[model samples]
Target: MNKIKQGIEKLWAGPWVPPEHGKMPYFWLLSLAYMGWKYAYVAPGALELAMLVLTLALFVPLYLASFRARGWQVHACMLAGCLFGAAWVRWNPGAATFFIFACAMAAGITKMKHAMLAIAAVIALALLASLQASGNMRFLFLMPILTAGLPVGVGAVMDARLRRSRQELLRKQEEVEHMATIAERERISRDLHDLLGHSLSLIALKAELARKLVHRDADACAREVGDIEASARQALAEVRAAVTGYREKGLASALASARASLAAAEVALEENVERIPLAPAAENVLALALREAVTNVVRHAGARRCSVSLELEHGVAVLRIADDGQARSAADIRHGNGLCGMRERVQSVGGKLALRARAGLELELRVPAAVSSGMNP
Candidate 1:
């Protein structure tokens, strides 16, 4: 059974020869003609035996010669050979001359204008051959030209269709590669935001608190120093997580970090809360923005109260962390590395980050809610 199956597979997978395979069919037809003529006309004579051997011998070399030529040239030569064989089969029949010329025109004329000229020449030759031979001139002149013209037109149309298909396939391949590049850039941006934002925010809060207590109380100053040490550890862990592409930071964790940092800095912390699920990417960027805003308040704004708000509005999770601190001028904020890092994080996730001051310092972060909903609650 296995052997039978293997044989069937081999039959289906056999080599594919094409329309060009039919180019040598004329040689086989010539051999068959010779055999038929021998039996009908020669009557067991030496001349008949000699003709049979000659016809069989002609078949092998002519077929092999067609294979050795280049593709278009081989088809052209085969058409010419078919016409010659037809003429030899019945010299009295002027139609044979037309057949030979029809083959020559098919092989020789690649352009449409040239093909039409070649067809006219074939018809002219058949007419001249019939005038010379005393055969039925009218029928001999017309039939062969009509038969050969059909296949040549069909082959040309097939060639044009194949070329157009190849061009369309190449265009689609380029579009797919362009889309892949965009997706890769977005993934990289999300990872960077998650890694650095929270750690930096906590650091800024501890630094600000430590600065304020430097001259006031030694015990409180030591506590601020301890907070800085904890923030540094958290930053290191976040960096490793980002590098490894871990999507573990949830929206709640980020909000909690923002509140804790503000409280540690002795700033009044407030939350306008909502339950917002987040994709790993949105969670990372929003968390980073929150951290940066809180840090900026402690380091630059000398104000006291800070507010962190998270809400779902119009299919987007909006996070705004504002501090009632001494607002820095726009020029000062732009020049700072902390704010620049925050912007980079937001941009990575296809979201927006802005720092504005109305009464105090306001840092607003917005990301698509679709991204947030993808995360674990």
Candidate 2:
């Protein structure tokens, strides 16, 4: 009996069984009830029940498989099942359900016009079969329209909504990509302006002075030439600072950039940084985090002064960045991609970010020592 039950289970749910309390199994039972509704009034004979079981065998596999099938395969399964159901109608009135299922499949696979045309053809064939075997001619014609209408209409609407949703998602993706390209251009422009502006101007002035002094004082001319070389080296350092973004130049380089940026923004910055030995990846994360924190302070905090401090305690690294400007309300702080990105970067390294606006705007970022030592999060 147990073996028999297991075999029945395998057959009903397929050899590869779906999860427990599955909707697909319930749906199959509903289909069976729909196709056997006529027999609810009168008891079906043994032969009729046998034919019912046979029809179920043909219907179940094709119906379940149609969900994941595509293109002509889905159409083929629907057509095959519809034919079986329509044929079963010779012995039963309720077998009209297969045509309804087929209508839905058609509607899902193609546009409304094509689905309606295909359903119409199937309805005509079913109507002819009904005319031959049906006891009630009026019902035979009327029932198909009523049953097929609901599934087909619902399927068409669902298809349209799905198409619209896909289009909307695609539009959003494209918009994000365009914004990223614009941001990249702006970053490059800003970096170049900051990097070359001061150095280039000084180099040009020193070169002109050296040209003027060439006939007057040999010693002064050599000094101006030395100044030009120094200016060139300074320009190279600025370029290296921009490139340090990917090179993991650690907290010192990041702090230098932050100081320069803050000065550019007319914001006074105070720093208290302690040297902490961290793995390269951890250093890079902290550096990027410092850069982002300073950027937010400069752009949104509207603070006249900012301070940054780093410390280590109990196998954890703590960094704090605070600004004097609390112009914007904390309630208005929506953690857009910027803050969300910061959070993600921190969390990926087994760290957490804390934000508070009571005493101006402050950020506390913490990283575990395990992560800093190159351990996986």
Candidate 3:
């Protein structure tokens, strides 16, 4: 039943020509000539047989010539051959009727210029013959011109519409691809933020607390060391999240990270404003920036204390992490891949990040409210 339905659909779908398929009209004409010889002219008059054989012979070269000519040239040659055959048949002088049939076939292959020329030639011959003979000139000459011109005008209009439709489809496809790229980038940014932010913050806090207790309480210091180890494991998980581009980081989670990381570094954290909600992309970038900045402080800064702050100011969320470590030399302050990655993340969301050393090494990140509101908790 399915096969029957498919066959029916194919019947309605029209003929499917292969890409390499070339001129078909000439092949069909050859088939007609074979049929004429076998069935149409077995008992024909002697002169009629010769004329039919000659017309059949002419079809071979004329069919080959049609493939080589472009535009109206192909039609012009075919029309000329048909007119020659019509004259040879010597049907009635009034019945150059085959020339009209030839003109119609030529019109299908000819461009406007060649078609006009063929039409003019046919009209001129018909008018001259009509002056000598007696038949309606208007029906033969005027009607063919009007009929042949219709296809050329319609073909030109359809060609223009097809070109415009193709261009519009390409434009729409490009727009869809561009939008998909942007959405993918944003999704990646959000995932990285959620994965790494909390772990790094916890590690910083444990490290800071450990530093403070080292002299006064060795056992308490050991506990802080254990916490640091746990934080490192969490950081490992976050790193995997960043790599995989899954998960979403929330503002509260990022704040918890800041507190943990600063505490581990023995840095004092100050918060001046209430929690501000952020878009997942903004939160992720901001969290990653915080992680990089704090990691830099722990690794390079000889500072005993650091300060971490998050505030909403002028419709932007601002994050500042500063350390009282010795100011980095210009050479030491040069950015690594981690810092560059953080900068790129911020920039992707139309935010700004700056790293500098005033009295101390400071990393500042500011994200606009428009970007910060879309984050998932």
Off by more than 4 A, model 3: 1-233, 236-249, 271-273, 328-331, 371-377
Kindly indicate the candidate among 1 and 2 with the higher TM-score. Answer: 1
Model 3 Cα shift for residue 179 (angstroms): 9.1
Expressed as tens digits, the lDDT of each residue in 192-283 for candidate 2 is 44345445645665677789899999899998798778668856875676554344345676677677567656789888877676666566
Give the TM-score of each candidate: 0.48, 0.44, 0.53
Q: Sorted on TM-score, highest at the top, how do the candidates line up? A: 3, 1, 2
lDDT per residue, candidate 1, 301-337, as tens digits? 7768887778878877788877666665665454465
Q: How far off is residue 145 in model 2, in Å?
A: 3.7
Overall lDDT per candidate, in order of appearance: 0.59, 0.67, 0.59
Candidate 1 — which residues are off by over 4 angstroms? 1-194, 197-230, 278-282, 328-355, 366-368, 371-377
Write the residue-wise lDDT of candidate 3 on 247-306 in tens digits. Answer: 355455555665665666566655543467766766766766766676666656767777
TM-score-superior candidate, 2 or 3: 3
lDDT of 1 at 186: 55
> What would the C-alpha RMSD of candidate 2 be, to one decimal place?
16.8
**Model 1: lDDT of residue 46:** 75
Q: What is the lDDT of residue 44 in candidate 1?
A: 59
Q: Which candidate achieves the best lDDT against the true structure?
A: 2
